[model samples]
Target: MEARLDLAGSPVAGKALKHFIAANTALAGSTLPRATRELVEIRASQINGCGFCVDMHTKDAAHAGESALRLNLVAAWREATVFTEAERAALELAEQGTRIADAGGGVTDEAWAKAAEHYDEDQLAALVSLIALINAFNRLNVIVRRPAGDYRPGQFD
Candidate 1:
């Protein structure tokens, strides 16, 4: 139940986290829709089995008014009727981004084009950066075996 290391207590990780927080602030202000952002974050976390991120993002999304149905159905998003095309595209990109090793070629042209159909250039940039950032957070938490279910909305803020 204990994390292997305290990321906040380590000077190296603390500095990295500061810049990460700043980068996230910049991404938050991007043109990507707030709901889609949360969805992508949660979906990627779930795929990576990063319980800390799943708890954090789900709480944050709910605090921002994301419906419980959508949150519960992120793993089954393809079959769910609760999402828009834009949201679907974002989720597809997140899946591809998170499962790069499985796919063997990273994100495919089809997924990228599907995502491009919905998001503008800036939003696409944000989505790509968000995927990378969330994966980084997921890997850090998963490798450290961070426990879940205790996160509060805005805990990081």
Candidate 2:
């Protein structure tokens, strides 16, 4: 299916995305582990039902040496045993952060505490920013019905 609009072709969307990409580029230097970052992105995308992001981040994660098993298990991360404790913490935070409106409390104190146990202040900052950013991207893509499966790793770089 075609997207409702070509985001890259629209000046308004394009300008906003350019800044978004720039922000992400800056966030890429965060101390959060690359593997965890990808996992968080994938998990948030999965929760948001943004196929384009899932496809892109999964492929990008694979290219960056994440195992197929781990990638496959991200959706079932709670039930899967392949992830590190830190990864699991981040995933839990991502889920809670992504589904903020689903729960009356937004994010639970327990989830935040768990994440804080695993991440330093800088890493937590990055995680919070990443979660918010990915959710924004997911909403835009899902709203536009952006088709998935054609993304090449680093295609935008």
Candidate 3:
């Protein structure tokens, strides 16, 4: 498969993506745990069928020592036992946030309350921003038909 456009080669895309990439960099310094952030990204990418992102995040998470068991279970986290309550809360929020179009009311109050229970305000802010960020990345990659399975860990870094 081939991408519709070369985001790296296109000055217009590069200009737009620079800000998105910067936002992601800032979120990396936030209070949200790296593992949790990767899990959220992976789950959102999966929901969006963005294989390039799924490939990128899964490899990055594994490179950072995320267990294969946990990584594989991200798609089925509700039935998995490898995650903590906090991680579960973040995943739930990611799912709800990513599927907002499917849910009429956006994220449910219960989901937000649960996430709030597990995360401080700053952490919650990071989680929210991460969700939005990953969804944007997913849309970009999916829209362009970016191929998967060639990503290297730290390739973007």
Candidate 4:
């Protein structure tokens, strides 16, 4: 399927995406674990129905040596036994952050407390930033009707 717009080709999007790419680069260098960041990105993309992001992050994570079972289980992480408590906490925060409207009061105290327990302040900051960033990406891709399944890991780089 064709995207409704070529976001990367547009001047408006180019400028905005430059800043976004910069922010992502900063996050890439953050203290958060790559695995947890990827899982959070994937989960948020899934919740937002942004197929392009799901394809991108999943492929990127796999190329970085993440296990297939863990990748597959991200969607069903709560029921799967493949993840550690830290990963589960991150995933829970990602879900609650992504579906804030559903929760009404935004991310609950329990989710934040759990995430705080698993992560140090810097990592927690990175996680919160990641959640916001991924949600923004999901909105942009979903808005532009970005197509999925052709993304190569590190294609953007």
| lDDT, candidate 2, 31-94, per-residue tens | 9999999999999999999999999999999999999999999999999999999999999999
The root-mean-square deviation over C-alpha atoms between each candidate and the true structure, in angstroms, is 0.7, 0.7, 0.7, 0.7
TM-score of 1: 0.98
Stretches off by above 4 angstroms in model 2 are none
- lDDT-best of 2 and 3: 3
After aligning candidate 2 to the native by TM-score, how far in Å is the CA of 38 from where it should be?
A: 0.6
Each prediction's TM-score against the native? 0.98, 0.98, 0.98, 0.98
Deviation in Å, model 2, residue 112 alpha carbon = 0.6
User: Model 4 lDDT vs. the true structure?
Assistant: 0.95
What is the Å distance of residue 89 in model 1 from its true position?
Answer: 0.7
**Residue 112 in candidate 3 has what lDDT?**
95
**How well is each residue in 60-155 modelled by candidate 4, as lDDT tens digits?**
999999999999999999999999999999999999999999999799999999999989999999999999999999999999999999999878
lDDT of the candidates, in the order given: 0.94, 0.94, 0.95, 0.95
The TM-score, computed over Cα atoms with residue i paired to residue i, of candidate 3 is 0.98
